[model samples]
Target chain A: MEKPKHKLLSFAYFLESSKVYNKIKKFVYDLIENDEYKYKRYFDIFMIFVILSSVTLLVMDVKRHIPHWLDDFDLYFVTTIFVVEYLLRMWVYSDIHKIIIDEYEESSYFDKEVSYYSLFTNIAKNKWAYMVSFSAIIDLIAILPSYRGLRVLRVFVLFRAFKMLRYTKSLTGFLYVLKNKKFELMTLLTLSTFFIFIAGIMLYVFEGDNENPNIHNLFDAFYWALITISTVGYGDIAPVTPEGRIVTMLIIFTGIGLISFVTSIIVSSFNERLSVLREDRVVQEVGKKKKLTVVCGYGLLGRLVVKGLQKEGVEFVIIDRSEEMAAVAYNDGYHAICADATKGTIFEKLGIDDRISHVLCLTSDDIQNAFISVNVKSLNSEVYVTARCSDQEIATKMEYAHVDQVIMPEEVAGMMGAVYAGEPVAFEVLLSIIEEKEKTHINEIAIAEGSFLDNKMIGEVDFERLRLILLGVFKRSEESKLGEFIFNPSDEFVLNAGDNLVCIGYSTAVANLKRKM
Target chain B: MQIQKDILLFGYGTFGRQLYKNLRSRGHKVKVVVGLDDYVEVESDSGVDITRINIKRNDDILALNVNAAESIFYCAMNKTANNLFLVLTLKSLYPQANVIANSNSNETTRKLKYAGATSVIDLYEATSRRIVNVLTKPAVSMALDEIVYKQNDLQMLEIELKENTFLEGKYVSEIKFRQMGIILIAIIDKELGYELVFTDHRINHKLDAGDILVIVAKKENISKFQEMLKKG
Candidate 1:
């Protein structure tokens, strides 16, 4: 499936032939469009700074006298950067030579001469698409004011503020909210325009000529109608006639109606986005943590898992459909969001494939857990997913979906009952130990590279003196994941770096041993 | 030492089957009762006795004789209504029998208790607690799996101190359980209404007769300790 890279023919592939040129072009493309690139974020911040400073200099020039050097720096230095940015954006929009050669190579089957003309159009189309793009137009006009030839268009420098939209995300979110309600806004705009036109004509008829000195002409009547309908009521000119006064009341009432209608539309748009904003905040918080566990339910089981995870100091997000349940987790100061977790695309939205180390499907409904585990495994095959099922049939389905850990609560409860009946005291001891209520724990501490415990033999550290029992060691190697647990390791066993020491002790003893790790 | 009791379990589902296996493996004679329509999984174990009856009729349940059973489990995790009715019927039938009901939710546990189940095992809470342990305390869960479920030499036992036992009248702080190759978690005092007073701290309480001590140790060490208690 590998494509042949050798260039066969002439000047059409000349630019593509240079590997360095292609490499540089790809880097610029990444800077311009790739959201994951580190330099792209830095580039955005620098651009934002340039736009802000340029706008600030312009504002200062309006009243206070800015230094000439500062003015020249703003007018020339900022314009050059804007021009360079525009050119780079246009260049990265599409690879011109690749398009030309690809079209030429394809058209060799048909009309070769016609492919030349088509190729010309193809290149023009790509460049023109970039040229007329909203951001592109803003980039161009933002720099045109610095040209001595375009002094008449000097006011266009304010477009630099519009350029700020390209860098900031929250500003773009505002535009998205308005764009979603475009249809309703347009209908309202049409209705208001119709009322304004009719009111302007009615005012002209009621107060034309000597009937009212303010409404001498149609322009004046229309201007009065505009001011009255907007609820501005400049009162520079008033209609003295009784008919015109009635028309004024109608215009004022219509303004109030349109204002309320517009207010409702905008308010509803924000209301819809408010939930999304909270979800986004949770998503952003998840992105910050190194190891994240995404629990898709906040019921009783979810609360139990959350408490254990909290004690372990693990970063996790709680997602639930019920507001009160999610609120229970949210109020507890954990990252929680009220949203349905069974949606197909929800895992990708949560960025589970990247930072999530575990996905817990703890919803009570078996079918819900199945759907969630399937979604999680589909998104990230490597992520360890644990799902709780109530029965054996659904447990089979969950395992079939490739869940890493399929938990049957009934089976667990049955085992608990048997253990309790057989060894009630043992069950109580194990339960308290598992729940960590008695400050006893069986914990694992990883030996980091260059740590004090690294390269030390197991016998060197006095685990007995530390009041802990060494259960085993989990050595991680590049070949295997998490490695295998070596049970009852010999005293002469050398403790290497990146080995996890599994021990059973009180929490303080574990903490003491971990101090060396 | 444990005197294995006869366990009578009613219902046929995942919970019932699982509990059946668990109790049977613990050397207890288990009798499983299922409805006529129940699909029972085939097992050839001689220790189990399965019977099919139309449990829908209250007279059939009333006529059912489980007088020999000391321990009864009502596992209607699939049918909450059945557990409620069965627990009520059984409570009337055997007033002093130990009836343990397995329920999927907390609310069901409460309702089963109201119907006179001596104890209700919350299926959700138990499983969730296990899962939490598996995730947060992997080593602990692994150790339990090795010794407890795997039936190894090392075992956990709860010893109820008999009158004039070795541990009687001794403060909890006076004993070093770990030196005997045992881990002591708590002491449940019968006089204090059976609360688990953790031994790690708050160790001022005197160990009384009839108080239960939860400890984990090897089988031989446990037997030796119990022998010492008997001779005390």
Candidate 2:
């Protein structure tokens, strides 16, 4: 019997001293610090719901009588959770202390391993520091018990709602914005205070207790001044004299302007903060997408490309050096980052390298486009690049840089002129195709491995019956041979599994073909 | 057709002045229309001449005798929307006259075309195309340059054969383009849904009725070819 007891005690000692303790401590630390943990995220959501309901019950209890059992049940349940969270946080801090000591030792910050007594003292100091932290104080207040019949102590229960602020990133960002604009806000506060004080003194001097029976004391005058300045006008106090009335009118107008000024300051700061948050959201969203197009410029050509991509429902991010242009793109419902695209790290920062399929450099400047092309290639060599060049020299240079396509607007225009001069009707048809204004659309439909069109002969399929014209067939094979484009193949031509049919037909007919494929 | 009066040039910016000089050098009379707010007297860079006219109202456009002028070139400043509006207004006024305008993008080019621009010169695209042509397709570009820039009067014509035409069932070699001094660039087979065949297949491929021929030759030769095919 004694041996068994001895063994059980030793087992308990081993559990406490083993790495299992540290692993469990790390798990709890992750729950507190990392929101990516699935269980932790669910727990956080559940806790938020519980806190909200508890606060609502507390508020309701103030106005009406709540059942004692329900109130007690809520208070006890939330307080118990709060206590457990607070203790867990403290335990994690202790684990952090051990980690710090180990790091210090590894770095030779201390010449030797510290004595047990010294380590204990250091941990005690760390614990003391954590106890005084703002969150820790709030946690303690949340779990504080209210004595029975001590009605005033129950107000501390509302402190539970403040815990929600810790989990809300946007609220913290708002607080940060407020802190950044503290000087401006303080100036407004000072101006309003001086105005109120002066107005209160003038009102008291113009209508003292002798003339106005409602005027009781200096504090009453100050209260009336505040109410008037806020435009609340509770109507509990009034000035009888004309001078006081004139002063009140002036005060009312000043209050109106000052209030608007304060509101404008808050609103502008909030908007600035919101843009920053939106930029972060864009980064996060880009991370989620498996394929994206990064447009490096927001000029006329860039805007046209963006519009086309938007019509096709393609995911893209616009990058421009001009803040105004970026803002314009953003307002136009595209994710835009205002940064120089020449910087190699910008792509990494935006996670553009993760799954970027295309990099379109459409800046007006040829040198900028070249730089962007090179940077994108260096960042991800597999990404296809298309750039706009102003001259033939730049086009050759871009081509040498392995850019897939170098477009020159002037050269294309000259070609268009030549085409117009040579074949006017054909030119119009081409223009209609590019403009997508014609009822007939030239669409490419791929034949899947088991598709109905796969392995079918051209003459076997009745395209005439469907009102679709097969313009070309691009056969892509697995052996890495260049795809062959058979333009208007013979009736005996066989359709392969990997063939992409470029058809010209009405939009409805094309849709039907797509459905059939 | 020779113009009796000077040509009217609208919007005397850089492009306008360049057009004025080019027309003047080419022995055509030229007049420039500046904005109403512009100074009446302005010096040219060459210090040889200055010509300016104000355009404040619609009558100003009419006063220029736009219909009688050789052509009106709207090489205004870089305001595409305003240029489009100007082209629309000009087209409304003189629907029969040739009015060429400059555009920036493909979209604007299409808009300008619909707005009745006789020839829309997208300067960027034109320059790019010229550069690309000079670099990649020198031979074709040289021919196009001669026709487009030099005004060689060479024509590109498409002819569709009728049923029972002599060309039916005849190989492309039988047409004898070399003897006729014409180039058969491609054949558009109607049976193949108008697919363009431009390879050596045209050398021995049997021609059929309703097969459209895309050929490039002088104006008179095209008509001669058509008459000979009709007689056959």
Taking all chains together, each candidate's TM-score versus the true structure is 0.78, 0.63
DockQ of each: 0.35, 0.11
Which parts of model 1 are misplaced by more than 4 Å? A1-23, A26-41, A109-111, A147-152, A319-333, A336-344, A445-464, A469-501, B6-17, B27-122, B129-137, B149-232
**How many clashes in each candidate?**
0, 17
User: What is the per-residue lDDT of model 2 for residues B1-232, given as tens digits with 9 covering 90 to 100?
Assistant: 1123345556655445444544554455556666656543346465433334444356767776655334544445446776787787777777776666777777888999999888776554444333333333333234444333434456444566777777888877666663464655556777677666542232356778878776555667777887878876
Q: Considering only the true interface residues, what is the Cα RMSD of candidate 1 after superposition?
A: 4.1
Candidate maximizing DockQ: 1
Would you give me the overall lDDT of model 1?
0.76
Question: Which portions of model 2 show Cα errors greater than 4 Å?
Answer: A1-45, A63-69, A83-111, A114-140, A145-153, A166-170, A186-264, A277-288, A319-350, A371-383, A396-404, A457-471, A479-494, B1-101, B105-116, B119-232
lDDT tens digits, residue span A1-517, model 2: 4564345445545655779776887788888756445467666787788778787887888789899887787767777788888888887776543444454455456555435555456767888899998778987887664444766667777777888777765677777877878999899889989989999999889887578888877788899899999999998999899988998998899899889998898889988777567777776667667777888898877876777677666678989999899999988988998888999766886665567877888898999999999999888888878788866677898999999767766444434433443344444443433345556544566777888888888878876567665555677777643265554556678888867776555678878877877
Location of the lowest summed lDDT over 10 successive residues in candidate 1 chain A: A1-10
